[model samples]
Target: MSESPISHLKFSTILSKLRAGINASDLHGSLTGYLCAGGKATEDTWGEALALDFTAEGIQDNPAFPQFFRQTRAQLDDVEFGFVPMLPADAAALETRAEALVDWCRGFLGGVGLAGAGKRGNELSADAREIVKDFATIASSNLDVSGKEEDETALVEVIEFVRVGVLLLHSELAPASSPRPATSPTSRSLH
Candidate 1:
């Protein structure tokens, strides 16, 4: 797979500096899920949905965060299926990457719920619902594994599944011309 447009370590460092209290993988996952659920791609909408303070000092001035945000949105909107979840580099420990995947899944679930997918359950096609369920299972699963070749293979497969599943969800729920509801602060909270 091609390298993710956003580097996990670099983005994490930026978030830490800004005191965002969220990891890069989780934040990217949430952004993907929010878009998949038809949320607007505006910075304000994203910040509100995630309860992040983009107005925080240095947040707006920092070019990296905004660049990452735009790149993520572009990837999802790309016709070439360029979307990829932000995670540790391949050189990182396998266990660390697995844990990041778990975090990503959890963030995705939260994001979808925040975007009102749960309230629109009947609107979701069977495949979308199944994808959500699978994501939930992955979010809750125990991913610990010894550093074996098979474990590496399995992780890669799971990541691919997640990448495709996100694209499918985006196409189904947020078609390019579809009219999406405005996400207000009140509506952004996950119940």
Candidate 2:
């Protein structure tokens, strides 16, 4: 029998689904840090690219800043997923460097059918809202949000929106390489 919608439902389940099969070692603690802080995500191949730290931990300790960054490196030591907003300074810095990218992402995904046109701008739609409520339980399989609040709706929307933007850019900016046979050894390789 097919799985019921309830069986497939995922309200606050972001980490488990998002980080499933993701290696613990591959989850890095920072991106900009990897770029400037002498740190790097685990792995050296495709996995490495995905092992980035989305959480702005540095800004969390301060209050003069507004929230900037969200997301974090999945932890193998524990199991859970939660949202963490970056401080204003960190957010400002990120916004400065990736404002265009962020804007493009917001625009790209805003219309992809995630965010609504009503009161809850960042909140999920009625259909998706239920799924978001159970996000915490779902993400608990691949994340570590021991001390953070369980707020996956906004984070989920933000990430999905950004993903859409990135995907759109890829479709438009990525060079069209010659198609290779599926069975070719190099078929899966990326330049």
The local distance difference test score of each candidate is 0.78, 0.25
lDDT of 2 by residue, 43-124 (tens): 2221233333424443223321111111222211112212121112223233332332233222223222221222342443
Using TM-score, give the best candidate's number.
Answer: 1
lDDT of 2 at 45: 24
Query: In candidate 2, how many Å is residue 137 off?
Result: 29
* Stretches > 4 Å off in candidate 2: 1-150, 178-191
lDDT of 1: 0.78
* Cα error, candidate 2, residue 84 (Å): 19
* TM-score of model number 1: 0.85
